[model samples]
Target chain A: MVLALSGAAQTLDSTGRATTLGLLGRIDPRARLIATLLFACVVVASHWIPTLLIALAASCTAMVFAQLPIASTLKRMAAMDSFIIFILILLPFTMPGEAMFTVFGFPASWEGLWRAVEIGLKANAVVLMLMALVGTMEAVTLGHALHHLKVPERLVHLLLFTVRYIEVLYEEHVRLKQAMKARGFKARNSLHTYRSYGYLLGMMLVRAMERSERILDAMKCRGFTGRIPLLGRYEYTKRDTVFAALMGALLMILIGTEIYHAV
Target chain B: MHIVDGALSNPVVVTGAVLAVGGVAYGLKKLPMEKIPAAGVLSAAFFVASLIHVPIGPSSVHLIMNGLAGLILGWAAFPALFVGLLLQAAFFGFGGVTVLGINTVNIALPAVLAYLVCIKGVRSSNLTTATVWGGVCGALSIALTTLFVAISLAMTGEEFIPAAKFVFFAHIPVLVIEGLLSAVAVYFLRLVKPEVLGAFEEVKR
Candidate 1:
């Protein structure tokens, strides 16, 4: 939620960051879904290195087809999601396995470390697939899909409002935080902070509730009756089906290969 | 956190998907049409709450008030959380479809714990009790949730975080952050809009 919004307003203002993350937060909706599905296949096939590499290769090829900017994509992929990236980097230190090459007095087990890398890459692969795919598409599209998928009316309506207002709340959070800071309010690391946070949250909740009604009123006046309009219909052509099938078959092959190698 | 595609066992993931669907259905069955406005507002509140990242470690983690959810929504927290998790999965992909149940259980643990705190443990005389205990509940909630998830992943024979499930031991500071956040949220709810607390208490009732 933060990524998409900041990417749009702040990052997009800077050509450098925009070009880098553009592949992720700027893909076509249809392509995004396909890529997301393909990555999921890789998740199931993770046991095999050959399969994992093959999936990665396939993702790369798709990235090429998607016209993702190579330099910017790689750079942004690393820079933007640094926390998960850090967690990935930390896995080798924690995992237990046989000896690999030691660096700076750290006994890095190749097995444990490589496994960490695999997990990390798998995590990245999912992100890339989404970035390369739907990271850029409007979330409302997914909400609409949720509606068509027969998600509960209450749930879908809640979801639609949540996503829409998340941005609003983010902005509110920033303005409020700024105000707090400007007023010399500092959040200490202790139990006492709860009162302020609770009170602030309550206020935010009230404001958010009022906004929801206003937004609903505006939307209802404009003919939104708690339902997202089905914007465009997606068709499964034989070729698309064939492609999907081939992808599935390939995933199965990878799984089989991984099991064979593991055994 | 939304678990991504194929992140955990298909059975675990599918089970969560199934239960998440059930949670919403269950909530819907019980939802009074009159509270639709509050429900919508809470949903939006939840989205924004998560957007505001609370500092943890050298980095930050978003606030997910499963405790507050429990305190206010009681069983209804199930549906709210399910929707939030679903969005996180679809949008940011923090947690996955497979780990949904596990995540839900993890988050819901604190929420229900908070419910227990408000009902069985804490005194309603002081809003501070709700705030303080709610914070504790929040901290313990995610801590347990994370512990359960790490253990579950290990049990699944998946190598995601093969280390001891005691990452929550490392997450004490983070959980404290959650406790503080939840307490504040609950405190404010009681102070100005005591009605919200009334509604919340009624849920526990």
Candidate 2:
């Protein structure tokens, strides 16, 4: 399990390699960001299974257009599913409706089952669209786009700084973990194990705090007057217009279908 | 404990979004120019720390450590933790986009509360005294977080009530683990460099 976790951590480090290599990649980050927000809101508001399935399809298409690795992206989506699977499985048994089946002497409702499926679909559709649109961009670019989108300057600065250091700190964590392993530290369900892990975390935080002091002095020396000037310029090219128009039309279709189903 | 998009009712999501914005704004207000780097680096540290999974009986749970975060960051825990969640959603897909606001509030509010409730105890000069307080903060934050998550789920629909109750009960072990880890971590910090614990107080003064 530790090996698997370390492997997962290694993959996390490579998120920086999410390249601007496809159709969605060439579109403006600001446009992509807005489109993703609109897409998520619309998808969440949707009720019909068919509409949601279509939304999921649309997101899958976005993933393809973004040139995201298919198996691994879906694996990430499945990982999220693992967290909510318990709640979803409980829904059918707990919710009141016509009984679909009996499990362990409990009746499972069709209505509850449908509700679970709806939630699962809505979640996947929205998450996939978000990953395809925003996750494909560089973290720094996302920060710049948020800045352009008029998210508060301070918040954006915080985001930029956090993004800048995540990889560095993650590496530090890996090194520390390696050193602990070298010392024959095997984590188990015991007080000693927990305390060791605690000390490990404390040591990391202390080092991070000390590192921040040096960073602050260096930034001050470089004349960082309360704000790091955002240096990237984003232009809405023809591709952006086409992407925006297409996204708007897709969203309208979703809303229209949902309204049509309601009325 | 991320409440994904579409699981929450519109009113719940909107309310959460509004509260989160207010919290982040306030947190940013308390964060001065000189302190941004400190907060940012520490935020990154917490983000990395969250990846550490401690073993239980047959399973393991990753650390949330929002309690430790609160003890160190104070009100600034709001934006710092929010940033962590945002990055998680974007990169890792642990949480969704639309529900980002509620997830932020659910996790970060408890962190801020941990700060308010346990800050004094954590700042005690004695090591054991401060360590116990850190455990309380850690356990208390997780308890509150689970409650908030359950409330969000139950508010969305009557059907979610059972699932909501289960969420809290299931996390009891995690609460204990976080408490133990936080206590020792605080002990180490107090022994090694007492300044980190007092830095927030210095800034406030």
- Best lDDT among the predictions, by candidate number: 2
How do the residues B95-178 of candidate 1 rate in per-residue lDDT, one tens digit apiece? 543455666765665565556656443336676666676567677677766676566556545345544344546566667777
Query: How many collisions per candidate?
Result: 21, 0
Provide the lDDT at B202 for model 2.
Answer: 44
Question: Which DockQ values do the candidates obtain, in the order shown?
Answer: 0.39, 0.67
Model 2 CA lDDT for position A80: 97
lDDT of 2 by residue, A50-69 (tens): 99999999999998888878
Ten residues in sequence with the least summed lDDT for candidate 1 chain B? B196-205
Error of 1 at A154 (Å): 3.2
Model 1: residue A199 alpha-carbon error in angstroms: 3.5
Query: Candidate 1: deviation at residue B114, Å?
Result: 3.0
Deviation from native of the Cα of residue A59 in model 2, angstroms? 0.4
lDDT of 2 by residue, B7-62 (tens): 88999999999999999999998888778898999999999999889999999999
Total backbone clashes of candidate 1, pairs 3 or more residues apart or in separate chains: 21
Q: Which CAPRI tier for candidate 1?
A: acceptable
